[model samples]
Target: MYVALFESSHGAVLQPLDESGLATGEARDVGASGLAAAVAELEAGHPRWVWDDTSRWYPRLLAEGVRIERCVDLRLSHAILRNSALTASSTLARSAASSWDRAAPETVELTADAALFDFDGPAQLNSAEDTLAEFALQRAAIAGAADPARLGLLLAAESAGALVAAEILYAGLPWREDVHDAILARHLGPRPAPGVRPAKLQAVLERLREALDAPTLNPDSPPELLKALARAGLIVRSTRSWELKKLTHPSIEPLLEYKKLARLLSANGWHWLDTNVRHGRFHPEYVPGGVVTGRWASKGGGGALQLPKQIRSAVVADPGWKLVVADASQLEPRILAALSGDRGMAEAGAAGDLYAGIVASGAVATRDQAKVAMLGAMYGATTGESGRLMPALTRAYPRAIGLVETAARAGEKGEIVSTRLGRSSPPPGPVWRTSQSEAYGEGATDADVSRARGQARSWGRFTRNFVVQGSAAEWALCWMATLRGTLDELGDGAWLTDSPHLVFFMHDEVVVHCPADAAASVEAAVRESAAQAGRLLFGAAPVTFPLTVAVVDDYGQAK
Candidate 1:
């Protein structure tokens, strides 16, 4: 059964629909104050709640301690089906663009004072009738897809991810401001006032100026620093760390230190602490399906995706609880093995560390060589050590390497490639199409053809990684979804919002804050979820997705 929900003039309106998506009953108008109670009553029937946007409707319910088991996020589902190659022939895909194709509304932080659902807002697609219509279109599109089951699974996983995003935001990551301040003070010295450098940064700047003999060198000024470096006889083309490291100069060390500290101060210093962290929680706004490869992207909260190792200690669990930090080991390579059905590659990944297994198989001379070769194979590397090692890797894991090679070739030809579960890559943009046409048409210049080839290879590198990355993201969604269900079952009879639940999720790593007693259960659930995700995506495939799980009070102690 499906229950379609929409915000109307009265509040939230819910209408029940049969399995075939036909209306089964009249719509019920529930006021803002009664929404939670009405949803709680509907939960007894296990109906999949269909809503226009999960982030808008779900967070308030979660705040009220109402957790729905399943939902159909129509907005997310619409984006997938409209662009999916498998559903291209469906009416939904063929229909002219409407407001449905518009970008999602900007995500906003939900406060306690905010209304449950806006009833008197400007008219949009939140009417009960409009939601029912969109739901029917999505269902029809999925039903008419080439591989409906796979597309359906993708939709289910994506929707589950939406729920998890909302939940993770509500139950913000456990953060310790004191620890963060300590880390900052230790590394950069006491936090300096606005527009002034910290003690350690000032000290480094003094040393840098003396070393370069510039007296008034400003490390923050890139062009000025470049001139200073040249004057000191370190002729470098760029000030990039990798390039700078190649030069030996008294100023080099302090310069690098200055850059590192400056980044820390600018990206996640005291100001960041004041703005992002609230009430011992870091509420990062996670955008589900944000990346083209399906990875989650964070919009705010101080570089949530790029948390520096220098401050990870601040991600401490609450008192009397533990943080279960688990990351899938060699996720992408293992995903490649499964997707390509490469038995050799699968066997190599089965041992937990795919790179070590590759070395053991004599695919490459050393672990580093194996790593470079595999990355080259996936990323279209065609020069230097990676390129030199590619032939050996290709010979050893033909299917796995060949799969990426095929994707690269397709990309070079401006063809679209789909991931394992049917998320197709978007076609080349107008610029790329124009370049290729210019290169191939009459009277084309040699430079035009050369430029076009370079662009093609650049895009090829992207597409080559897209399939593996996108599929790995799907696996992650499944992993989190399975773990969420497991945690809910384990927390039965307890208020889940205050019980053991997921608090943080990076690309492959997840941190669960739970009572110390539940650490073992959570660890077990993490491992089980990895295996389940593998089975769900690639049934009977020999590849294994192993997780390195650590139970610790501080997230930094996990590894």
Candidate 2:
């Protein structure tokens, strides 16, 4: 069952849709004030709600204490169908860019995804008729797709991700402002006033000045720092940390320390606390499908995804609750094994350490070499130790290695490569095509050939990893979506905050904020969902995804 919802001038409109996406009943009118109640009433039947964008609708519903079990985010689905190779022959993909293609809604600041008020964009398409038309096109595209099952799964997983992102936003991650402040103070001394460096940072800055013997040098300015270093017999191109680290100077250690502390101050300092955290929780704005490879990204200077490990100690559970942290072990490598049907690699991975498995197979002398070789294969590493061990790794796992090699060759020829579930890579842009074309022109120079060849190889590297990374992302979606449903069955499971709920999600890691008593159940659910996700993506491919799970009072202990 499905309910296609649209923004109505009077308030909102809901149309019942069957499995085929055809309307099964008349449109039901809902006032803006009564929207949440109306949604709750219909949610009782557990229909998969269809809407223009989950970002625009789900956040508001979640804010009003109304939670939904399933949804089809038309905006996200449109993106998939319009770009997927499986649906290339459909009218939806063949048509010119329409309003649906450019419909990211006007977002609120702190209430980022909570788009309660109506604001019109140039290409807004929220009418019931417009929504229905767009949805019908999506259905047609999926039905006409060469591999409808995989495409449909991709769409469903993408939409579910939208829901998960909104829910996490609404629920907010447990954060202790006081704990964050303590961590900062311990690293950088007391919090300084605006534009004033903390005591510890000031000490490092002074040391940098002394080491260069330039009393007036401002280390904060890159040009001044470079000139100072040059004048001190440390000639370097830039003040970048990596270049500076290679040099043996009294300034190097202090400079690196300064940079690290400065980053910590700027990214997660008192200002971050003032803006991000509220009432003991931090609400991070998540943009689903933010990465082209289908990974989630945070918005609005919160730096949620990039939360430095130094401040992880601040992520504390509530008094009577625990944070259940679970991360998949060797996710991408296992994904590669499953995708290629490499029985040997699969067997190696069963030991819970694929690299160890490679070493055990006599492919390499140690786990480190196996890791480097495997990373080289997946990431197109063609030099150094990785290159040296390539033949050995290849002999041990030919199918897995061959798969990435094939992807790399296809990419060099500017051909598109799809993930295991059919999320195709976008074609090269005009500049890339032009570069390759010019390299083959009659008057082409060696420089042109070299540049074009390098670019092709670089793009090949991207594609080689794209298949593995993108498919791994899909597996993550399935794991999270299934875990979400399982967690929904815990406790009352109706009011999101009352039950065990997901509070954070990294690429392959998830943190569930659960009551003390339900921690064990949530842990089991996390592992069970991982297994289920493996089966869903591979369908008995003999690859197992194991997770390292821990129930801790704070986030840092889980690691």
Candidate 3:
């Protein structure tokens, strides 16, 4: 009989055993007989089951069945089994599939959730539907919804927006939701009253026909498009519900269209997502190191984590589900506190808000100005309005500015910058050096060269922020690993299987898609993770970090 040793599936090593069921440490000593004779001797001693790659076992067994070994010592291997009968193997494989499905965590399962069934709604559809619907509605309401095609677009937009908002509220991290909401509050005071519930998507012709003379109107484009535009800071709403205007530069409209295309792509994405959801629950995969700049990336679908208000309405909860949302208050500024070890900054964060500190510091007249100034400083945006307003900020928070500026300068020199925790960015490529020299090269004395040099200088400022942003990403990664471990201990039985899993992550934000029943646990898990993340990133440091959380029934509310 032919014999071969097979490796265990779990990667364990097996050794020979004696008749007494004890390890015979001397297999190498009797090796003159080679592996075959040694195996026979081991069978005489006691049948020893050795773990090795299964490739070894399959070949020898294919020729003939191996002689029986009497070794009592053995280990269990969980390899996929093949039966004599084809029908039997198929049944075994089916059973294995069911077992894996049942044991898979909610986060992992979301990858498969998007496909199974169609829960078509504002939250579930693409940006085109919501934007088109809202545009049609607004045109009808304001411009009289006279144009059927435009009106159709508006209503479609609204429907899509509402559905997307529902999904976001259901999946996003608390701090991420807070940042989104803050951006919304900056422009739209509060969410518009829930306008219309989403139903099955209408045929294109019928939608166009209905929009022709629709009575109701809303100015906002479809939710998905609006979200893409808002993130790029292109659109803002006026006081009236039906009044909306574009804020971003017209030159960037192509970029806007690209975003729209992305939104459109999300339609197919939504379909794929639903199909992937195991059973009835969709779980979008959350990639921890997804963003190049330390933000979260969605594996199965890109739920809009970067977008602004109104669009959030597109993300909706499923049937029999309510969104439980929470967001952190002033997360970045608070992170700065822990990073710099500045007592004043920490105190400012501890006192509820950071803009208030800027006001108290006499940095700016209102919180809005403070926001523009601080953001401008970090981004190194100095030429436009934000740049003009930056002096006062640099004067007040010299250290903050100093930190970014110093890093920016080092980056211009093509050097790596490190955060407090020792995480460093990758080295600048050769392109950076060539670009820097070309801009400031003595050979080029024209005005264009000077401008180029200035632009390069500006890029240096951006590099400074990249260091901070990138390091912040590392902190997020550490937090994710820690939280995953903690939640695993909660045991599978204690948690709902179809609940929200980690669907998306952005720098300093995380999105969890869970069922309504698990929202409480989700919130607790986030808060605990944030706390734990702080400890891990800043040990023994006197810093206080607080996350602003809001539980919303809709993504719009969370926004």
TM-score of each: 0.94, 0.94, 0.51
lDDT tens digits by residue: candidate 2, 142-261: 888999999989999999999999989899999999999999899999988898989998988899889888888777789988888888899988878888889997889989998899
User: Better model by lDDT, 1 or 3?
Assistant: 1
User: Over the stretch 1-559, how does candidate 1's per-residue lDDT look in tens digits?
Assistant: 8998888787888889876578899988898888999999999888899998898999999889899989999877887888788999999889987666644322111110111111111214666766888889998888888999999999899999899889888888999999999999999999888898899989999999999998988878889999998888888888899999998888889999999998899898999999999999997677787766677777765666677888889999888999999999989899999999999999997777899999999988899999888888877789999999988888999999999999889878878777888887666766778888899999999999998898788777777888888899999999999999899888875776567788888889888989999889989999999899989999999988888899999988986
The Cα error of candidate 1 at residue 371, in Å, is 1.1
The number of the candidate with the highest lDDT is 2
Clash count (model 1, backbone only): 0
Instruction: Mark the regions of model 2 whose C-alpha exceeds 4 Å error after superposition.
Output: 102-125, 235-240
Please write out the lDDT profile of model 3 over residues 32-119, one tens digit for every residue.
2244444545455433343221222322322232332211101101111111111122332234332111121222111111111111
Candidates in order: C-alpha RMSD to true structure:
5.6, 4.9, 21.4
Scored against the true structure, residue 62 in model 2 reaches a CA lDDT of: 82
Query: What shift in Å separates residue 410 of candidate 3 from its native position after superposition?
Result: 1.0
